[model samples]
Target chain A: MTRLTFPPALHAEWIKIRTLRPQIGALAAVPLATVAFSALAGLGAGDDDILFSAFFGVNFGQIAAIAFGTTAVSAEFHTGALRLSLAAVPRRGSWFAAKLTAIGLPVLAVGLVTGLTALAAGAMTVGPQARDATPAEWVRGTAGCAVYLTLMALLAAGLTTVLRSGVGALSILVPFLLLVSFVLGDVNGNAADFLPDRAGQVVLHSSWDGTLGPWTGLAVSALWTAAAVAAGLWRVRVRDA
Target chain B: MTSIDVHDLTKEYGPRRAVDRITFRVPPGRVTGFLGPNGAGKSTTLRLLLGLDRPTSGTATLAGRPYVSLARPLRHVGALLDAQAAHSSRTGRDHLLVLAASNRIPVRRVDEVLEETGLTPAARRRVRTYSLGMRQRLGIAAALLGDPGVVLLDEPANGLDPEGIVWIRGLLRRLAAEGRTVLVSSHLMNETASFADHLVVLGRGRVLADTALRDFIDARVHPGVRIRTTDPAALENALTRQGHDAVRHPDGHWTVRHARVDDIGPLVSAAGVPLLELSAEEGTLEQAYLALTAVDAEFAARQHEEVRP
Candidate 1:
């Protein structure tokens, strides 16, 4: 006689994300791309910050994370999944919250694993420079890397919900992460650091020149995620499924 | 006690009003056919009832409550809006599982529904690889998973094979027999006539007819005298001379509209035509549907955009 709650909805979303082969591959790429790219970046490393070099693979992983988030939301838009999902749950807000949580948790877990692997690989490549980083610094970078990637994935999920197209979200996000963040940084100066990718990535840098500190920078990225998520929720409420 | 009640429901998409101000009730222990043509707003009405789309004006509710207000919606209403609504990459079993999980339904019910819908063999296959018929079965499986009191299915037989069609016919019948309120929408006239006793006929986003199927047919169509004679031309001439409109079939049968057996029996004797077959034919549902829609078309033509229902 109980009402449907958040837990079952979350469980359902979890099952949906895992059952699909492509979604599983998208998630796997989060860690694979991060660790792999970090290893590749290590070979070219001569004299770089010990912590940031270990997390460089995170740059590549962000694209895959965006893909995972975008695909998770976009798949529901196609072929009438939204109709079916709404029919089953009916409460749009509760279902959406569950969907975002389902998207964030796995990416965060995989991102942490990727961070640890990247650090080990960096330690091998940098040789003696790895000892220069304090245990506290290593812990901060690994944890920050995971949280940043999870936030980016959630940001992408929120945008995908609004756009209702994975390609639409990825096309804007992927290119911005690859180039626009840097371009805006040079052109717009300190203001450009507020971009989601740049603001979130600040935690990885051993020394940052931007006005925002590590926590404040992540908070700026979170503000962008919150705005996208709010818009997406409004769209789902006002528009017909 | 549970019934689907729609009150003055209307849906407008820009300038086009897909579902006009229409209202009807689908009560328990009966199969109500929501019959309409392609653009008759059958799908649109069902979407609004299921809370997939908001109505421009009016209310659609189950047991006097809106669909979205139901805490456990799947426990009260099972719906199949589109068979292709499930993601292409998920296995058929997983799609039903997602629905069951969302509703707090037991996992074993998923297996039972799959078995009932004849999708057990293909349950593990991804939806992309399944045929349209298989997808339909999978959709039915999802609908039956919750074992809800009311069932709403739109175009449930769209892609079904003959055997699948027969299977669904029995399934709907059995569901109604169990005293569940079942509403099935379809544009196929004869297919609906076979299973439904109560009918809600929609034409141009309006309720053209809402009554027992027999009453709808009897009201819209007139009975005709079916006559077969050795000399078909002579029989036709006598009926025409008497000012009766007689339609002739390729099989040499003559159907005299608005005429009785007594009207034709005396004439056939006077015409000296050797009669092969003579009987009063009840007006068919097909004839009634055509007559009803044809009238609707004429009104649409006369009024253009101003025609209501």
Candidate 2:
């Protein structure tokens, strides 16, 4: 028997992602929504920590990124698509790894584009205030923004695999991001800092009071994503497709 | 050549055993029809065989290897469990292209399968716009994309029109003729009877009969002759005298069993009886299936009553 390679499997998964208009729409919406919302937030900036204001659009943009990842993985559950997928690639672990790679690369690309546009949008609206973001800070924030968004998307993708429904994953994630993280007062200390959205958003901030720095916060979020992905993998291997 | 070997395979759901200890071998180079009534574990067995579902006990293997263990399984075995198992928004060509790309098959193979399944004309259209027959064709196209040696399709004829049915029959026969192992399952006995050389009939998750199609039809479906004569009484007497148990129907026709029409015709002529109409009635595939399942159902009902009381 001929051994199946990972590249071709990843190619197949990418084809599945690009062929659907909804998935593409979800991906395109990320940058547009992020930049537009951040530009609006930039107009009302109070001069305190203007760097955070520039990338404020990420709060809204992350939703689209999450949707993109969730839909890409969850679409397989609908209409018995996963069965056909598994039939072609019988090694469940490899197929899932390929799936995650497919979701990660596209979101990473789009997230970088979204971060840069959000930065430019902020610079346009806040004028001199945005200039406070030094070149080093600018580079770190943009790179951090891309990584943060990619991690969020992957986290959603993992959750979707567990729930087996795009809508179900979105219901839990969207509300948690919008209501639980934002609306609820930051109950100080390590607990609030560890929430997936808040923990990752530390990178977007120029300075922070919490113990975890930008990279450490992103690492915490990556750990969360890893746990979710591990759970999803375990579910896929054990559950009947 | 590839063959399917199943042994003592069992699957249980809660307290219910969906598949019992069933054993059968499907040889290569023949269309083996997996025949069973609805809820008779045919789908479960197929899932178990494909490694989609783990068996409770025993084993089902293709060419001496479990399906999951086979590297590049699409190159070795192609299976279609559901015809509609595809994204509705993707075009038929794109769907096949994705499967082709997964196996590292050439982009050209996608078009070839589309042409083979007669879906090339509508390949670009989204699958949501397709009819059920068209979807079945697309599923078959995906199944054949790898040009695998073993093909297992569950109810590939579900929503097909007459022309599509004939097309599938020819396709299955041709696939088997290529020395490939073909296992096609369906509850439609006559459709399977037309092309299948071997049959593995299942009832209540058990192998009720596993034999050649001809032998199955011949053994279970008793052949009889329907005879109508100007003088029914004389014809009956002549047949009865010749040790042929001929029974007279209320409609004045006689049914003669265990006697060929040639022997009866000669016997009746010698008895000076004018034969108005004589027709040979052989057992049909449907009849044999019905007869087999009837007993199975009866036994199940009896067991249910005994347990409840």
Candidate 3:
């Protein structure tokens, strides 16, 4: 008999995500929504932090990221998918880790590509103001864009595992990301910066007035994702599949 | 050693217990039919065996290791708990491919299983478009993908056509003949009688019977002598004088309960009775199983003792 190991389980999860049509759409929508909206934000031209403006399409793009994360795990909760999955690999820890890894890698790759394309699209619309953006800022923004999107996707997947429903995870994350996060942005001080989305978006700005810096902000978001993932792992360990 | 051993395994969902302290052993080279009603916890027990559901107390081990602890569980134990467990949007081939990759099974094996299950033509179609029988075939293919030592299937014949049913019976028998431990769960005793060699019956989360298929029927049901003769009065007199209580039917045949044909034939001959037919009237598997698990044990008991001389 062959041994069930982490590497093969991860490969299996990757194939699962790659093959599903809705999951593919969710991944593709990340770049499409990001570049399209980043170009629009560049044309509007009122925001002082041109860096955030260029990456602003992430507001819409992150929704797709969360969808990808949610669907990847939520698919398991469908009729007998998780049972089949666990039957193939009985180690819940390895299977959950593999699932998250599969979610993180693809979004990170797509997020990086989306970052560069959105920056160029934003520069075309913002005119000479885009030239003021330095190489250091571009590198940081792009890296942060990729990492931040990946973290958010991981966060959604973690939540999906906890909720065990794609629609359930989306119902909470998507609306909260769009309405609650935006509304909270207008109402509070640095305390609002601690919210997962706001905290992670800190890196995209060329300058900031918030309490958190670039890496520290993403760290806060990572902590939230970690907590969600821990709870999800616990659920997988204890609950009936 | 047995391939699968479940001991004192219990699962309680709030106040109600789904599986209550049940124990049984599944030996290799035989098909053990897991027979139970819908709410009798057959599926729950299978889930516990596969480590898909945590047990309240006790243990279920495969070859002396908990399923989760096995190095490659699918390679050791293949299970089909639910045919609908596969996602509807994924193609049938991809579904098997994902499982094959998970256990490190080669990709070519996926095609082989598809062809084995007669699903090669529909392998590319999404599961949503497939019929129930196709889904069952897909599920069976996934179970056999690893070609594991132990096979567990639940209600495998639910949506199968007559040909599919025949195919499954042969497949199950062959798996047992190959010395693999096969556990097939169903509520139909007659269906299992065709393929299963041993039986593990459950009713209300408790083991009602576990033994060889023939013994299960033999122990619960008394297959008494069925005698036919031209002179019914002489045969009845001979049977009564031998201390046998024979029931005379309206059709002119006599059914002697708790009586053996070997002992009755000589008695009738000495009594100058000419026999037309002499045989044992064995009870059907369905009749035997129903008697054991019948809703009222008291009634079943009455039926059992109803054969008293």
Candidate 4:
């Protein structure tokens, strides 16, 4: 037997993602929409926190990440390509991990760039009266956005594994992100901090004045991501492909 | 020794069994046609062997080890369960490239397989844009990417045109000639009869017959003597008196059951009957398969009737 040393699963995932033009277009939409929408939202408001204003794109961009991530696995299930994937790499865990990694890295990069550009554009339009974000804020916001997008992608991927359908995964994820955050807004101040979108959005603020600290909010989001991924892993491992 | 060894494999869905204690071996250097009717569990069997779906009981080993146990599985076995299972947006070459990468196979090998499977012209085209035959060729290209010891293809001829079918037949023959164990599943026995040296006939998730092609044909098809003469009644009577069962048709030809043409010439000569035409009628593989499956079909119908009534 030939000693197979290729990263076949990872390579396959990359090819799968890149070949689909819609995925790339979706990834690009985050920054474009963030900058455009945030710029529009910041027009009337003056001298606001540049960091906070710049990240408006990520709020919308993360949706694209979620869609991309969900489809990464769900597309396979829908097309029945999971059989070919499993047949190539019988180790289910490795295949899942490779797919996560391939999708996670690109989403993270897109998130970071979008976050940084949004902040810079907001600051440019707001002029010097805009509270200049500290380097620490820039680092935190950009890095946090990247981490947040990665987690969301992973969460979407996990949810997709559980649902095994693209439309089904999206139906659940979109409502949780768009509607549930508002529904939980007036609940027990401390309790609502654990909601994934709430926790992830905390990364946008320059100050840690919320119920949970910035790091704690991010941690809570991470927890949600871990739980979702663990559930997905369990489903993949136990269920028939 | 480097072959697929499936022992007492069983797979169940809830309370219903899809594959029930089925066992078979696919040896190297020949194509083993996994023949069966629709819903006979051919795909389920391949899924178990490839570890896509776990067997409920027993084991399926590839090259003396379980499929999941192999660190680099593609190097051991390559399988194409569905031709259109690939991401429709991905190009054919990219699809093969991805699989090749996993097995540490060279990227150029993807091109080689593309050429080999005759998908070179459409290598750069998106898979969704390709025709069904092109997609099938692409799937085969992916299977051949690793140059593994064994290749498994399920319903590979499902969507192929006549020309494409002939191409696939030749490709399978060439692959088997190179000493690799090739297992192909198809519901059409006639298509398989041309390329398959050995056959494993399945029905209702069970193996009806596991034997060589020639043996299957011989066992199912009975050789009979066809004698055409003006005195059909006399010849029929003479053959029937000589302990051969003969049937006279409305077309004035006599068909002798369980007798060869060589035996009929001497029988007619000795009986003083002038023979106008005497020839042997060979039984076809199709007839044999129908005879074998007819019994199973009847049993299934009776079982259904008992349940419903």
What are the candidates' C-alpha RMSDs? Answer: 3.2, 1.5, 4.2, 2.5
List runs of model 1 lying over 4 Å from the truth.
Answer: A1-4, A182-189, B230-252, B256-275, B305-309
Q: How many clashes does each candidate structure show, in the order listed?
A: 0, 0, 1, 5
| Candidate 1's DockQ | 0.67
Q: Name the docking class for model 4.
A: medium
Q: What is the DockQ of each candidate?
A: 0.67, 0.72, 0.62, 0.60
Question: Compared with the true structure, what per-residue lDDT tens digits does model 2 show for residues B42-122?
Answer: 999988988888899999999989998876778888888998897999999999889998888888889999999999999
Q: Write the per-residue lDDT of candidate 3 for residues A91-200, one digit (tens) a residue.
A: 89999999999999999999999999888887888778886778789888899999999999999998988888888889999888999887776453558789999989
Candidate 2: give the clashing pairs: none
Q: Best by DockQ, which number?
A: 2
Q: Which stretches of candidate 2 lie over 4 Å from their true place?
A: A185-190
- How far is B72's C-alpha from truth in model 1 (Å)? 1.6
- The parts of candidate 4 lying over 4 Å away from their true place are A1-6, A47-49, A182-190, B231-234, B266-278, B298-309
lDDT of 1 at B257: 84
TM-scores for every candidate against the unseen true structure = 0.92, 0.97, 0.92, 0.93
lDDT of 3 by residue, B202-293 (tens): 87788888899999888878888887889988888888888999998899888989778788778888899988988988877898887887
Model 3 regions more than 4 Å off: A1-4, A185-188, B225-244, B250-254, B259-280, B295-309
What's model 1's lDDT at B49? Answer: 91
**lDDT tens string, model 1, B1-309?**
789999999999999999999999999999999988899999999889989899999999999999999877888898888889888888889989999998889999999998898888888888889999999888888888889899999889989999999998999999999999999998888888888889999998999989998998989888899988888778878888889999989987888888889888988888888899999988778888899999999988889866556
lDDT of 2 by residue, A1-241 (tens): 4565677788999999999999999999999989888878877778477778888889999999999999899889977689899888878898999999999998899988988887887788888767677878888889999999999999999999998888999999999999887765555475878988888888888878887788999999999999889999998899877
